[model samples]
Target: MKLSEVISIVDGALITANADLDMDISSACGADLMSDVLTHARSGAVLLTGLTNPQVVRTAEMAEIVAIVFVRGKRPPLETILLAEEKGIPLVTTKSTMFKACGCLFQAGMNSCDV
Candidate 1:
């Protein structure tokens, strides 16, 4: 689904990017642990997390994840945004809790980021 559709699905706000709405996502993974993200996440997936640190950006970069949806109204620090900006990753925020956000996405036909 398009990023715009995802935002609409979860009532998310575009934080760092006016990303292209045509972006297609095949899967998703929600986690606060960067290690799990590193080990489990795959390409063309959106990451959902409450963590707001630069490490999140780094993990996304390494995992080649280009989009992030922050759960529970969490927002990353400016430093994290700076890194994400440099990496060209999209960041979005939502008021919904992690569970609800993931569920909404899943119901919308988004799959797990893990293989």
Candidate 2:
């Protein structure tokens, strides 16, 4: 699914890269540890996490993640959002827990390699 499609399906807001709503999201990776994300996330993947630190954005950038979904009602810091804007990374906040968010997207046809 495309990034915009995921946002539409999950009711996610664009925290950054509003212009990049059309970017492709071929997969997803859910983890709280930035290290795991950096090691395993594929290109153009959406990262789901509850960590709200700037390091999360940095890890996503390094791994080339397509988008980020903050679960459990978490939100990244303003500086992190600004950096994401500069890097053109799409970020979203959801009330759903990490497991539910990932499950919802998966049930809606997203996958770790679903496409």
Candidate 3:
């Protein structure tokens, strides 16, 4: 799936200054634990998480996550946003909960990062 499609499916808005909206996403993973993300998320997957910490951005960078979707309409602090922007990782936010957003993407044919 494409990042644009994920945005449309979850009613998400890009929070980053610039991002490749056309980036191809290999899969999706919804997790709050950064360790879980590091362990299970595949490269090119979009991470659906509620964590708005700068550490989330760092974790994404380490895991090679293509993008991040902050659920429940939560917005990260400016520091987090800046880190994401600096790292060239796109950040998105949605009013939907993590479960709903993940379900929406799954229903739309996006595969899970789970093996």
Candidate lDDT values, in order: 0.88, 0.83, 0.95
- Stretches of candidate 2 off by over 4 Å are 113-115
**Candidate numbers, best TM-score first, in rank order:** 3, 1, 2
Flag regions of model 3 displaced more than 4 Å. Answer: none
Worst 10 residues of 1 by lDDT: 17-26
Give one digit per residue, the lDDT tens place, for model 1 in 1-115: 8888888999999888556777877789999999999998988788999999999999999998879999999888999988888888889999999999999999998887756
Candidate 1 displacement at residue 113 in angstroms: 2.2
In model 1, what is the error at residue 37, expressed in angstroms?
Answer: 0.8
Clashing pairs in 1: 28-113
Report the lDDT of model 2 for residue 58.
92
**Candidate 3 lDDT by residue in tens digits, 1-115:** 8899999999999989879889999999999999999999999999999999999999999999989999999999999999999999999999999999999999999999987
lDDT of 2 by residue, 1-115 (tens): 8887887776777676455776788899899989888788899899989998888889999999978899887778898899888888878988888888888888997878332
lDDT of 3 at 110: 95
Clashing residue pairs in all predictions, respectively, total 1, 0, 0
- As for candidate 3, its clashing pairs are none
